[model samples]
Structures are given as structure tokens and as C-alpha cells.
Target: MTARFDVAVVGLGAMGSAALAFLAARGVKAIGFDAYFPAHALSSSHGDSRLIRLGYFEDPSYVPLLKRAYQNWRSLEARLRTDILTITGVLQIGAPDGKIVSGTRSSCELHGLAHEALDKAEMARRFPAFQLDDHEIGLLDPQGGYLRPEAAVMGYLKLAAEDGAVLHFGEKVTAVEPDDAGVTIVSDTGQYRVKKIVVATGSWIAELVPQLRRAAVPIRQVVAWYQPQDGFATQPQRMPCFLRDEGAEGSYFGFPAIGVDGVKIGRHAHFREPIDPNQPNPPVNEADLALLDGFIRKRVPGAAGLRVKATTCRYTMLPSEDFLLDHMPGEKNVVVASPCSGHGFKFTSVIGEILADLAIDGQTDLPIDAFSFARI
Candidate 1:
């Protein structure tokens, strides 16, 4: 026997879980499917934490969506009775003219956001953990912080189930065929028919949607956690999340230890080598450690202590590294959402709501033109 639903959400990681949760809350007959269980470490959403910042350096146009995303995140926390977002302030540091510093200042100025501009000395005084060159400056965004990725995913999935969403975990979706009336989704367990479909599959997008194989490429990324030494404090009160544009070495971002007794750091532009998500993730190597060592030695104080652990994840990137959200060509019944390039988890709250809106209403009030696949 086949199952039927008003909407079938494929890949219930971040976006799909939110879509299902929203639809189910609305009393829509929604069903969700995922290749792995929610909050599983195999995918992008498994990382312990994700940074949330209002001063987006990628583009200032993201501020509006971010504002809405913040509200949604708060609402989700209230609804689920779970603590998710933690505001520890954020510092975007680099040369005054660099993308990380200038772009963030531009966004804050344009959006009328509250932020502080600190020179090298002020930065050192305010955040003792950071080591800066004399010419470097820091743009501190007080609203920026981190989100617990695994907990957020589980919360959304749990609420979705309570709201009447039928979820099939560890069920691989083999194909999604759109028809005149709706969409037909075939999985390893059974077939599902729905009036609409939302494809939020992250790294495995190409495997299911052949047309997007070339557009969405998955890149291997590694994140490492290190115990702070004597001088620096990893606690939220002292150290905030940080991003630095290290000129040639590439951009690096990290968070102060939350529950763990270590700080987490990852290169935003390192090890972007393409990988097949279907294959086992390669183990973290010494070269990765050496790369991070350079950053820690130069910038972060007391971050060179014992290296606790490191893990790898896939980053599905577009050429521009912006998000990709749109409907399948000639098929309005199916909406495709790939909000991840690298920094996407923070926006999951609004992305899910947008996916639900697109799948049900066929339109959304949010500004998503920047992520339209038509541009590609």
C-alpha cells in the first residue's frame, strides 16, 4: 500500500524538518523522509554548533531574511521549550578594507544595526583571546552568537511528529517525479503521493535531482576543537564567536567552547575539495591540523593547547557560494531548497518556513531572489 499526503518533504535534516513541522502544525497532511535519522552526524546539521550573525559579509541583502530567521528561531525555542540560540557577541576581524571587516560594517550600517568598531588595541582589551595586527580592526556584532545544530534538528523533528507529521528515518528516497497534479516520491520502503514536494536534501541533492548535479557540488570540510591554554577563556562570558580573513591563508571562523571544554575552529575556504556524499568521509589528517595550527598560533591566544578532536562534513556549494532556492523548471508543484553553501544552518529556521510557504502557497513574501536557481 502507498501513503498519501498533502506535501512530502524529502531529506528531513534542517529545512525539511522545519517544513514538516510548520505544515503539520497547520493541520496539513505532511510526510517527511530522510536517508538517515534526524540530527545524525553523517550530514551537515550534525555539527555541535553553528554561528548566527546579523552582519553578513557575503552580502548585505541577507539582513532582512536574517531578522526573520532570528524571530523564527526564538519562536521555535519557545514552542519546543528548548534553549537553542546563545548570544556571545561576534567579532569579524581583518584588515580594515578586507571583505570580512568592511562588508560586515556595510551591512550593519545599511540595516541600522547596533555594532561597535574597535581598533587593534580596543579589540585586544575587549577580547583578550584575540591577537591582531596593528592595522587590523574588528567589527563586533552584539546580536551574533551560536546555535546548537543537533539539538535544533531533533527539536524540530520531535515537534513535527507531535504535530502529525509522518516521518520515515533511514528511508532513502530513490526518485522524485513531478506530474500534472502533484509529485510521486519513491523510497526504499514504499511509494508516496503528494500534492506538492519540497526537496531539502543537502549533499545528496545531485543523487536525487540529476539536473542540479552540475550546479550543486559537495565539498569536504573539516572542523577541529581544541582545549584553551592558560590565558584564554572559552566560556561564553569572555570569548565570543569570531571570523577572520587571513588574506592568502583563507577565512577562518570559530566558537568559544559551550558545553565542551574546547574551542571549535574551521576554515571557511579550506579543503574545499569535492567529495561524493555517498562515500565514507575521509578521516581528518595531519595536514588539516597543520593548517589550523598556523591560524591558532598567529591569532588566538591559548588555543594551541591540547587538540581534543576533529571531524569532517560536506559543504554543498554553488559557484557563488550563495544559497540556491527555487522551483523545478516547468514544475511548479516541486520546490527545491539548497540554503547551504557553507554558512546555512543559522538560517534554517526561516528557510524551513519559506519552504513550507513555497510548497503550499506557491509563493512567499520573503526575499529569495538572491538564491534563485534561475540565475545559475
Candidate 2:
């Protein structure tokens, strides 16, 4: 059987759920489909917590967009009456001149946001859990915090449903085609025809958007949870979420032990081989564990030598590590937003609003030119 709607959102994950909710709130006839439910651990949105900060180290252009994200997140929290975002502050630690520290400082300075720069000794004095090296420094963004990924997804989905959005779970999209009238979506359960389609599929973007197959590489990332040792007893309440640049090697980041009861850490860049999202995730090998263990030991000494529980997640990365939020090449009615490059979760709220605005009005005020496919 086939059904039709004004808008059909494929892949109702973090960004999609919020987009769907925004569209439904506007009284638009929208339908959402996901291979799994909103809170399912199968996708990037399943983690217990995601870091949300205003001073974007990736690029200063993101500062304006992040400002909107903060507002939207608060609006969602107020509407849902759920604590989706916690303002626990954030720390960017690295060499004083490295991207993690310098770029963050640049963004904060450009935006005139409140921030503090601290030397290694000052960092230790303020954030006692971090064992910074002699050359390391820290930039503190007091407005930064963490977002409840699972709760935010569920909250958006629930609000979307309440606003009259239909959702189909376990409906993996098999095909998508654009024609004169609109777009057609084929899935295992059935087919759907809608005037417009928003493809927010994260790691599966290559499958749905063939043009980006080479540009978007799906990578397997492991997130580990560890109980803090005696030195980190104050980590949960006092320590800020942090991003640490390991110099020329790469970078890794982590959040404080929130409701989860442990510190969570993961690398920002490393081995990222493509994978079948349907298959079971690859095992976390000793080498991977050792790498994380070494990171914790050297930088986060308080979090080292603790029991570690790890789970695998996927990141759809674009070449520039930005995002691809634009129409599908020549197809204006079909929008594609994907390959968040592992840092897109924090901006889901604002991205979703942008997608909805684009779907409805054909453009948005958000500074998404950096994320345009034309830039790729």
C-alpha cells in the first residue's frame, strides 16, 4: 500500500525528530519514518549525553548557529517540561596555540562571549581532576553544557506525535526518487509520496544520497564509560565537559559523570571505515581500549584505571568535517542533511529548525552556506 502527505521525513533520529516536531507544530501534515524508534541505541542519537557549547572550535561561523541552538533547546525544554539540557560548563584543553584552545578563543573573542583562559597550574587549581602537562592550557566556556541525547530525541518525537505527526518505526527506507510531482519513498513496510522530503539519515546518507557516497564516510566510534577513582570524586559536579587535543596525533573529548555515574570519552578523529549500519557493530579491540586508556591516564588521571564499559556508535563524516544541509543537487524539493562529522548532535535543535524552514519556505536565515553541498 502507499500513502501520501505534505512532507515525509526519512530517518527520524536527533535532527529529524526535531525537524518533524517543528513542522508538526506549524500544522503541516508531516510523517516520519525511522529504522528504529527515537530512543533506540542503534544510531548516533542514542548516547546518554552530548556536549552542547556555544564557542565552537570547529569554526567561528558556527557561533551564530549555536546561539540559535541554545535558544531552541531552551524553548523545547520549556515546552516539554523536561530537563533536556544541563548547563554544566565546558573546557577546551590543549597546547596554548593548538586548534582546541586557539580556535575556541578566537570564536569566543569574535562573538564577545564570556570565557576564561587558564594556564596549566590555573587549570589544575580550577578543574582538579585534569592532570594537564606543562605546556597545556584550558579555555572555559561557562555557558557550555551537555544535552540528554535520548531524552531530547524522545521529547521531540513525543511532541511531534502530539502535534499530529505520524511516525513509522522499523521502516528502513529502501529507495527515494524525485519526479515532476514530488518525491517517492520506498521502504520495507510500504511506500510514501510527499510534496517534499527531508533526508536526515546520519551514517546512512551514502545509501540514500548516492552523490555523496564518496564524500560521506561512515565510521565506527566507540564511547567508553568509566567510574572515577578517588582523585575524580569531584568530577561529576565540578569538572566541565572537555575537548582535549593530543597535539599532532589527534583529539578526544569527554563529559563529566552526569546521571550516568561515569566519565564518557571518545576520539574526534581516527580510524573510520565504512560499515553496514544493519550489521552488528565491530568489537572494541584491545588497541582501541589501550588508546582510550592511555588518554585517560595521561590527561584525565582521576578517570584512569577504572572499570570501562564501552559501546559502539557511528559517525557520518564529510570531507570538511562540517555538514551537508542543502537540496539534493538539482532537486529543490528534496533536502538532504547529513554527515554531521561527529559534532552535529549539539546543533540538532537549530539544524532541525533550519531544515523545517527550508522545507516550508525554501530558505533560512541560518548561516548554512558553510554546509552547502556546493562547497564540497
Using TM-score as the measure, the top candidate is: 1
Pairs with steric clashes in candidate 2: none
C-alpha lDDT score of every prediction, in listed order = 0.86, 0.85
Which is the leading candidate under lDDT?
A: 1
Q: Residue by residue across 40-66, what tens digits does model 2's lDDT show?
A: 666888878888888888888999999
Q: How many clashes does each candidate structure show, in the order listed?
A: 0, 0
TM-score to native of every candidate shown:
0.97, 0.96
Question: C-alpha displacement of 5 in model 2, angstroms?
Answer: 1.0
Candidate 2 is scored at a TM of 0.96
lDDT tens string, model 1, 221-323? 9988888884346577878899998887789999986756488899994778888888888888999989887778778866767878888888888888888
> Model 2, which residues run further than 4 Å from truth?
1-3, 231-233
**Model 1 compared with the native: what TM-score?**
0.97
